[model samples]
Target: MAPEPYTIPITVRGYETDSQGHLNQAVYLQYAEHARWTYLQHGGIRQSDLLDKGIGPVALEVTVRYLRELRAGDETEVDCRFVWGEGKTFRIEQQIRRTDGTVAAEVTGVGGLLDLQARKLVADPREYFRALADDPAVFGL
Candidate 1:
């Protein structure tokens, strides 16, 4: 079975808007990152834990699709879930939806664990991520 999506509520702030009074494209990435971090933390993986292990998460690629515009003061929810992959590489899908039920943005990203010292991808991923994926076979566990 696939892992269930995790969602967090968000509200657009004044500073996050662009000249047109809509959410800036860059902020969408930040929102996705925030949701990912929150999800990881909830799964028992913290930034310090990764640093202590000399590993850091790195995104290989990301594709974001803008569907609806989000204006300042709009209430939204960001949802994320893991799409398992081989080795240490995995994918994640995230969506930001307005309170009215319209999708504001959708992001699909490929990422992996990096060996900070070696400056290379880590073949053996940490257990926290494996648990997050909820599919041991995908990570060869």
Candidate 2:
């Protein structure tokens, strides 16, 4: 079987919903961001550590497609996976699914490494991030 995408459970809160009683579209990105952080942590890299090295990951673009509605108090899972791109750029695919396994939303994000010191994108990142970019199994090779 192929490797499973990284998943994290999230509970919808009242503050995350809009007047329509459904989760706000903007909140969906927050969920995906959390899952991305957790995924990176699982891979032994932390945002703080990256910042300390004067390098950070930055999202170039993010597209979110809302499917089913998610109301407050609903339990959901966010699944995330990394897709390799040219050089240090890569894509992350995330989905928010209801407890019943129905997809609530899908988020596709493009990102790349940044050199904090130089204040620009880096074509060649350090070994830690480079490893993730080069690993085919990370995206389920």
Cα lDDT, model 2, residue 68:
96
Score each candidate by Cα lDDT: 0.84, 0.83
Alpha-carbon deviation at 72 in model 2, angstroms: 0.8
lDDT assessment of candidate 2: 0.83
Model 2 C-alpha lDDT per residue in residues 52-107, reported as the tens digit of each score: 77888899999999999999999999999877655767778889999899999999
By lDDT, the best candidate is 1
Model 1: residue 75 alpha-carbon error in angstroms: 0.5
Segments of candidate 2 deviating more than 4 angstroms: 130-141
Query: For residues 1-141, what per-residue lDDT tens digits would candidate 1 score against the true structure?
Result: 665688899999999999999999999999999999988776667788788878889999999999999999999999887776657778889999997899999999999889899999888564656555444443333
TM-score of each: 0.88, 0.87
What's the distance in Å from true for residue 120, model 2? 1.9
Q: After superposing candidate 1, which stretches have Cα over 4 Å from the reference?
A: 126-128, 131-141
